[model samples]
Target: MKSQLLVPAVYDFLENMEFEGFDQFYEYAIKRDVPVVSKAVGNIISFFVSLFRPTNILELGCGIGTAAKYMLTKSKANYTGVDNNLERIEVAKRFLKDFNKLKFIHSRVETFLCGTDEKYDFVFVDSIKKDYEKIWYLLKPVLTKRSMVIFDDFFLYGYIFQEEAEIPYKYREGVRLIKRFINNIKNDPTAEIVFLPIENGIMVVHYEG
Candidate 1:
């Protein structure tokens, strides 16, 4: 299978934005061959976390600490990021070394969920969508009563529940799964679900008090 290629033009356009600390981080990531969060997505996440300001944050599929770095700079939350990719984890570790409170786990979300005993105030899900329900089930036992969960990449170009558009297949399937996941979460008596039209799309579910 062929690996995904970086879109230099897209990156360049996003790099032109005037977000504080973003340029430095972007430069660092490029120089070190790390993954950088898309500027659009980064802005959306920064905005969401800035509003919520959760004390503890958990991130699934954190690629090279782009979002983690942004969260540390933009919000006060202590963050723990997880990704199954060891090389990405290594890059993330070095990229985020300056932040004492930020931690990266070199494990799959499934494996991490199985062994972790800690609860989080905020959980950001951006990993494989096929594992959405499984990840939710695993996290349910470790989430605070009033914790918030954000599901990213739930929609691409504003179409929901379509799995075969011009976008990536995984992304298409992810959108479909997220819709189902949101519906289920909304119907759950213990949670309130809200969708944010930012960063492809973010489904924010808050466990009821």
Candidate 2:
């Protein structure tokens, strides 16, 4: 059976929660066929921002700044969004021009993480499954007290729980890496974690050190 966390009815309800002008960008994203966070995912991110009220946020794989817009509007926090795709960053910049607290960087996340000494109160990882572990390693050193690091797409469309033989040949390697990320965090002593059943799957890791 599939995970009930992503029930269509639940997603339909969350997707309709409104933010001014969000739908325009969202519709544009769909028409352009570019990758962007689902509305349910954006709702969850907004919920977290309201609850935690973090002052600084860093987002990985910030495609077109959709998620960044949600975070900025909801949290009213300073945001740094990184994406390797120049075209997406350009679009993100255009749409996010009004928000002085938000900035988009067109650089690989690994490179950005290496060169920045800044620590953030919240970190959102929306990168590919295989790269999560590497990003996590680099992300650890930049977390502050009571910081929350959120990892999106943890369920990988339910593929993470399937047997290796059952998974498609092309996805097996990436699925394995994501599973390794789950396992490592489960055993880690320095972080407190919660897995939320909101869209695909969301994992929030609270740094204890």
Candidate 3:
């Protein structure tokens, strides 16, 4: 029940898709043990979003900037990636040196939101599950009618902890919060929601026009 099985299948499918500069970064990320968006799922979402061709993109919790790099190369967007981990930001900066359109900020998502004056056509939420709602609230005011928001790792990895007794309540609580957040978005008139069965599950929200 290792998620490893899903990896190859997804890789094979994405390997055939055409996206310039993606394969190299994907390969590098896989080898460097950098936590980026899963190649298969990331490509699918990137491909779909590329059709819209967002002009400005924001990524929260950019671990090592793999996803931001891929998004910049694939969607050709002006990308800003934020992460609280300075060490990871350094690695991402080194890895993504060639992309002048991409920028990385070493700040917590919550802190960045309070001070940033820029609005984005797309916002990607990759922060921890417990902080999802908070991040969403911070960005909600800035989202334009056509802005798209993607939340990664929304699905619970059920098989991973199947055998463990006295499971942590936080895991269950986290899942519940995610579910509730999705429901709240679905009920809102400003956004339309869809859940994709990608790597861990990505909840995509398109701001209402």
| RMSD to the hidden true structure, all candidates | 4.8, 2.2, 3.6
Instruction: State the lDDT at 37 in candidate 2.
Output: 82
Write model 3 residue lDDT over 10-59, tens digit each, in one string.
64675456666556556766787666776666676667567778988998
- TM-score ranking, best first: 2, 3, 1
Clashes of 3: 0
Between prediction 1 and prediction 3, the one with superior lDDT is 3
In the range 1-209, model 2's lDDT, one tens digit per residue, is 23346667767777677777687678878799887887777877887888999998999999998888878877778899999999998888898888888877889999999999988999889988788889988988888988988898877777787899988888888889988888998888888999887777888899876
TM-score of 2: 0.93
Q: How many residue-pair clashes does candidate 2 contain?
A: 0
Please name the candidate that would achieve the greatest TM-score relative to the true structure.
2
For each candidate, what is the lDDT? 0.73, 0.84, 0.74
Stretches of candidate 2 exceeding 4 Å from the true structure: 1-5
- The regions of model 1 sitting more than 4 angstroms off are 1-16, 24-36, 156-176
Clashing pairs in 1: none
- Give the alpha carbon lDDT tens digit for every residue of 67-87 in model 1: 887677777677899998888
